[model samples]
Target chain A: MIVAANPIGQAITWINDPLNWTNPGGMLDRLGEHLTISALAVALGCLVAWPLGLWLGHLGRGGGLVVLISNATLAIPTLALLTILPVVFASGFGKTPVVVALAVFAVPPLLANAYTGVRQADPEARDAARGMGLSSAQLLRRVELPLAVPYLAAGFRTAAVQVIATAALASFVNGGGLGQIIRTGFGIGIAAGGGQIVAGGVLVAGLALLAEVVLGGVERLVTPKPLRRGRQRLGRPRAADATGSA
Target chain B: MSFRLSYLADPGNPWFSWQYVRDNSDTILAAVREHASLTGRAVVIAVLIALPLSVLAYWFRPLAGPILAVSGVVYTIPSLALFAFIAPYLGTGATTVLVGLVLYALLLIVRNVVAGLNQVPPEVREAAEGMGYGRWRRLFRIDLPLALPGIVTGVRLATVSTVALVTVGVLVGHGGLGQLIFAGFQNNLYKAEIMTAALLCVALAVVLDLLLILVARLVTPWSPRRAR
Candidate 1:
């Protein structure tokens, strides 16, 4: 294969390339495309998961079915999904297909989290919301949603990481991104050289790290400060209490 | 069904080519054999390293944060990217793949080990020490037993992640079940190849997880009964 050639020398050459650094647009454009695909997938996942999870959590039925399906879906390998999705959709290849495949992969975490978040919402809060002459819709929006933000955000973080990783798999189908560079380099037996492969790998890793940091920050910002403080205070005691009870 | 079979048997159809099957079979088998040996070795090495490292981390609380942070960063990198990054140094073939898998397994195993160690009630450890048990005796007899469940949980997670990450080895032409899936995609033989690989992966994960839970029970009799 391409890697059989002197990989170290090739990698060094790719890394030292003036064109990669000097023509920053190429790299940036690919990064932008990757981010766009990931973001869209995550957004679409949220739309599907939020409603379904809310319904299951509130109604307290079909949860087993939902969980079973989602868990099973989680096991459907990304490459398999990417391969099969195109056959069914006839889109052939591109960002749209990548987003669709990733969205499917992303949905389960959000759905699971949303269900858990809503189900685990303090019953007293729900009762209080009911006693306050609030409508069901109002109770859901004001009490359930606000309470579920942290869990939902946790799910979003999971989705974010999965999307970022799988987004690179899109390169296999000739869909453009850093994966394209990595796959092509490897395909041509140049990946062993370390330059294009390392560069591409670093770029992808950097993107994943950036996503985690940014989204984690957003999660913290959106989560209520009092709730955050409560979590800190409750964390140790709750664990101790749970262990004691057990 | 008979008509479909007849169509498949037709000489005019490309699907009837024995040449395609013959040429790919040797490559596929070799890839599977090599991938399995590499991954198996990697996991064994990782467990040995991680288990000791975890104990040391627990004993030296100050080291935990940095060690965990480094592992966590390693964990976040996609398997393909990680393999690619190491490929230059290790070069291709089994060694590079093994190194990448071991690194990937470390973060999960270490976290579980730490959690397992922490779960040993302080009083239990103190009582063991008070009984004149040396650190080694206490660790092996008391701590390790109690920690088994958590460690097992970590092992289960690592197993699934390892199975998935092993697929990335295909990118370097070190193939396994991923080769089957990839070939299925390449040949457009969707059901026969992709489904077989997918089922095998899921089966491997489930079976291994179940076996670990059994091992945990056998090891830790005092622990609460595991959830079904």
Candidate 2:
């Protein structure tokens, strides 16, 4: 029921306030907290997804299966999960529950990418590795791992962006983040010009875009040099296809 | 040490009692109906808008990059952030979440549809042209059928994800099962409310996904295997 009539103006005031910028729960702290949660979540996601993805990819047996299952998980609503999890973890309250949900959220992309990255490696090269007498472990570590870097990077970045966006829900669970401001501001209604909610929403959206741009840059850098050059030579159509879907 | 399984079977709990269902049937039915409408309307609207856009994207080679980039960016924005951002303009209630869900549905549907159309074999198009089929006729009769797998996949993905997202609508006061979930949270882990809410959400997702797959199969009888 609470919303400012002059929402945009309120946002400007909330975002610009020297006091709002300075306190423990200020914009800076919330942003930092959000980034921390995202980083930890993505890291944890990689831990859950990487090994199985890599194994299946190397074997060339179940990469698609793993990817399919993981992608299904990606469709699970984070807000729903965030609320549902706390009940399961009755003793758990805030960050831990948030982190667990987010970590699970991040897994699908990483799993999919890790699988495709390894499985899509040039078959001739893989055959050569086998012909050269590489053990399974050697084939995975020395051959497949390096080639999968780009896929790993893509997965990591995608999952990171997803986590960063979804992490805003953490505040609903009392987990400290930018969501608190929006929740409280909205709860209080049109008073204070509805600026706090507007400001919080802006900050979260801005953070999500920032993560995408930064990760996109990192993805470019991690891609194999030859493929990177090849991609540019092939130009925009090829590039668009690569990012056409998540 | 506390026993976890007992929580579900607690005799006093509404979750374990049919009486609770009878008592709350109207409220439960409304919430379920609300969630379904939110997801269904959003998906249908998204498909109508996105399907045309997808055809255009594939037709205009130059537009592909911009279209995909825009959708990808939109996809990353948190649903709540977008919901909150537009809430003031949309002015609360079901419309707010509907618009938000519609926006979220566009990227996936558009991408998959276009991808499906693009993957139609060149040889098939050549054959269609060789047979003197008109461009528009060939597209509808041939190309569209070939692309059915991917298009159906897009629909399936969007349907399931939208079902999951419907619960988040409660944050804006429009969610189906989410009302119960939020109540459970607010009521300090009311076991009956939280468990039932969670179970319903999970059930909705599974049921919707299976239903979509069945529909997809009936539509694309030729594509025996699942479209990857």
Candidate 3:
């Protein structure tokens, strides 16, 4: 059989080759690494960002500061952070720098969303809760948190997908991820590794898309049942909202 | 510890050194210029393409779903993957990077365009129609004016994100500040180079974002600052 000449065909061939998946540092290993790093970063981001955003949002005092901080962080280039953190912090190149950078990268959407979600909870419900003698904590837990679930979910999905995508940059710092495949392909020169590069791209893109779809479903599932029914009404504008920010 | 010239000249590995910045000012400036130009051009082209497409989507509701979906899918593609995918075909250069950045910018711009058009009050459009304004004229004169804030918001978002994403284009050899960052990393982890480039990239994003905000305010003098 003749080797396929075009990169696309070669990419297909590359994916078909079992050796590519099974070898050490191959697709499977890289895929695992990618998932692990992304998960870790997102988890870290959520842990730090969500509570701060939620508490501040609930108080309604620090929205300005929160937005300001998040926006400022957003401007810092991910690649720059990824490269510089390891050296400046003396952390050495690897997953540490990658995860820290990605976690920082993930924070803006999560924090902003969590804050917005809780802040936008129904005013009537909050008043009723307050009148009913429910404490602020109780109100947050029973009323606002539930109301904020959708926004929180949206933010989570955004952060997760973004972390997964940016995690590929880890390859630049000798960190593990599926980006290794693409980097390796480039290292081999386009003639020979063109297929490899394309395959790597397809894999990363596929993974990100898969995450998006899965998270989208999770978003729908986690939404309150009532909101689910009214979602058609609420969902349309929110779709535009999500797209604009995320 | 006494501050010493030796530390600046330290061959070991200094986190930052003004001397490096001074020596590489030309290279740094070039990277900054390239970064700014690539981001600016990509966003401009994206706005150009997204404007017409968004109008079609807004005009025909059915098109909005598919348009947003396609652009959403494109947006979801990781920058590295997108660039790598294009590089094989575009052969790794500014064009490939530009195409990828433009595609990334498309969804943000398109969504905002649709959202902006959505913001055009039905009554206003009707009033214009009642005044015998043609559909095109009403759209341009009435709907678009109302939509300006939203459209500008999208453009602002796209520009800032593009500034950051353009650094990823270094994979294809076109990342403006990204080259310096990558070079710093690859060249024995030169902190000054990486820091300088990174800080400059951030500054560019902030400057451009402010410029857009100023433009938005100038265009929509009627509306106070709308939180993006």
- Which candidate's TM-score is highest? 3
Native A-B contact fraction in model 1: 0.31
**DockQ: which is higher, 2 or 3?**
3
Query: What lDDT tens digits, residue by residue, belong to model 2 across residues B84-182?
Result: 787766565788888888887888788889989999999999999999999789889998889888888787777777877777776677878788778
Candidate ordering by TM-score (highest first)? 3, 2, 1
Clashes of each: 6, 4, 0
* Per-residue lDDT of B152 in model 1: 81
Give DockQ: model 3.
0.47
Ranking of models by lDDT: 3, 2, 1
Retained true contacts (fraction), each candidate: 0.31, 0.36, 0.60
| Model 1 DockQ, alpha carbons vs. true complex | 0.30
Q: So what's the TM-score on candidate 1?
A: 0.84
For residues A1-246, what per-residue lDDT tens digits would candidate 2 score against the true structure?
Answer: 544478898788778888897798888889889989888988888998999889989888985577556655644556657866765565457577788888887777777778878887888888899999999999999899999898888888777877887788788777777777777776776455367877888888888889888988999897867887643221111111122122
Give RMSD to native, each candidate. 6.2, 4.3, 4.2
Chain A TM-score relative to the true structure, per candidate: 0.83, 0.88, 0.90
| Residue A208 displacement in candidate 1 (angstroms) | 0.6
List lDDT for all candidates, in order.
0.70, 0.76, 0.83
lDDT string for model 3 (B86-175, tens) is 888778779988998899888888988899999888888889999999979988999888989889988988888889888888887889
- Which 10 consecutive positions of candidate 3 chain A have the poorest summed lDDT? A237-246
